[model samples]
Target: MPENMPGRINPEHITIVLNQPRYPENIGSGARAMRNMGFYNLIVVDPENFDLEKVEKLSTHAARDVVEKIQIFDNLQKALSPFNYVVGTTARLGGQRQVNSPSVMAEKLIPISKENNIAIVFGREDRGLSNEDIRLCHGLVNIPTADFSSLNLAQAVMVICYELFNAGTKKKHDFNPRLASCYELNGMYKDLKDVLIKISYINPENPDYWMNYIRKFFTRMNLRAREVGIIRGLIRQVNWYGQKMYKDGLDHKKNQEADL
Candidate 1:
């Protein structure tokens, strides 16, 4: 909430999410990592036997405040619902879950973090995120390790926090001045999908399949509000034109004869 530039990271804009963490000490350490990097918002989803006392003890004086402010949720989806940008952390990589290193991710995050509430999610200590859980994320972060890629939950949190914190606070330069909000992007995708379906561009059986790729393509563009509006307007016109020509009630033969 502090007066920052249009595209600078604010602590209030960042959230650290721990999904089903087994140990309270890890949560505490994650909190401690967050505090060290100037982040405070913490969300814990379906944790196991979490103890505030343990968190307080492990987090120590500086990070105790983060422990006190933890928000509990029944599921990952619900916890991340309010955030505009959600980044899932993973050690394993392949398929759709191919992830970027913390430092590389930090560079991409800094701009988005300014205008949106960003959630950086870490999975359980024992097992990492499930495929379904990872699917909900807009992006994924993977820490590159020398031997074993699997990092402890808190250590992964620390690395990401440090990278993001360092990049966010560094020298600021205006980039992509007017980025659209996730809400705006979501709306645009919906309208685009609907229009594409109407025009038979999106197959009825697998409409979402093509739309997903389109969404990713546009996401990489980091479209601004005005850019989104321009695309929306074009789609509306196309839809209107298609509807006018293809309406069921239209007597095409009769209309052609009358015109002749």
Candidate 2:
């Protein structure tokens, strides 16, 4: 591992996350690809088959260290809780799935990685990340392919890891400040959603649909921890004022009935 230079990426800050992977072989190969690219942190969320022997066999000796250090979580949000920035990988794009190419994602990540922990999330083999999974991501990356868009899980992992490795060696000095971790951002979103619903700013029946636009808007800002706290505080104040006004209206209605 090289020292963290001004324009170089620190591989230690980057994590490879596999979400709901079906096969042990793909997990092993994904670890191997991370090792090839000088990345070591690997997290598996809700894997279907996690056979250690098979995983080690496919990963081989070269990546045994990576295999040994793999962290398994029952869900994606908990697995990604510690990361400050998350870039999701998906072949399908439309609706809110605005994606950047691997190289572009790599470029964007390099600067962010300097001051934040990053997770490059790859979804399942059959279907990529679900809409809910995509909501957790700060950004998205799509590997360009021919007409046959489907890629083997390991192959997709390797492609993304390769780009990050390649980008790390280049000299592009763009400084991005530290951003809030997924945990803090998710907390802020939860509170914001509740407040929005209380004010009828978003439809209570389907708040997530409206919240998606808010998510993108805030994601673009790359809010820091303090900024998130500030937003949450504002939300609390709004909630308080709304309740106070509602109480006052009820009191006025009761007094008018008494006068009658």
Candidate 3:
């Protein structure tokens, strides 16, 4: 709202990504947890356990907003595509990959959201996110536990949202609106992706090879709208340079042709 800012996306912009969640009750509980923690936007993708009407009942009073406004997507990436920043939530560490502990990641992101679109992703209630799914995120976050670590989807949402809420509130700056809008980041990604395609550096048939890691880095950084815009502008410049170089070469070739 202010000049070019997206108008407080932290409160209105946080979106929950539930990937292949298999329990209706967990979904409801997660929704309720989000509302209790002060986050409202919910996005469920390719869930295995879903009960349209039952979710509200399980949510009790906390999940009412989710029940009324829940949006469903066919895949996690599509759900994540629209977001500028994305973090993956998992219970199991799953191998030895570099990742930030849940609380640590929260500490990093709360301030970052002041400038970018943010999304927190929760895997299935049972198995958690696969190696690939975790790879898609900018950073990995999990609750500290003993040998076994498993968190209900709603419970996970609650913990993460609580951290974010607290982090935002304690800040010194005006928490009114610090980050970019959902649409701005979405458009920037689209523009950048198009540039990648133009350069033939990215295969449209398989964009994940690049988008995943990029998503993780940006999500972890919690970029601002202006930053995203700046990057998009840079991409445009690179593409223009590539075209100009191509045209100059063609002109030289034409001169040679005429001489022949």
lDDT of each: 0.81, 0.91, 0.73
Q: 48-133 in candidate 2: lDDT tens per residue? A: 99999999999999999999999999999999998999999988888757899998888778778888999999999999898899
> What's the lDDT for residue 124 in model 1?
86
Model 3: residues with Cα > 4 Å off, grouped in runs: 1-13, 81-84, 92-98, 112-117, 130-136, 165-222
Backbone N/Cα/C clashes per model: 0, 0, 7
Top candidate (lDDT): 2
- Per-residue lDDT for 9 in model 1? 60
Lowest-sum lDDT 10-residue window in model 2: 1-10
For candidate 3, write residues 1-260 as lDDT tens digits. 34343222366767888888888888888888888877888889997867877787888865686778888988876777666567787665555555677567766765456555678888877778887777556667877776656666777788888877665333344442444444565666777778888888888888866866665566555566788789889988998998999999999999999999
Candidate 2 runs further than 4 Å off: 1-6, 168-172
Give the residue spans of candidate 1 off by over 4 A.
1-9, 48-51, 75-78, 81-84, 96-98, 130-138, 168-172, 176-178, 229-244, 248-260
How close is each model in CA RMSD to the real structure?
4.6, 2.2, 5.7
* TM-score, candidate number 1: 0.75
The pairs that clash in candidate 3 are: 30-154, 85-219, 114-178, 114-179, 115-223, 115-224, 138-216
TM, every model: 0.75, 0.94, 0.69
**For residues 1-260, what per-residue lDDT tens digits would candidate 1 score against the true structure?**
23363334667888999999999989898899899999999999998978988988889999877988999999887787666677888877886555788888888887676567888998888788887676567788888889867788889889988888777444564443546655666678889999988878889788877977787687667677789899999989998888888774477777887999
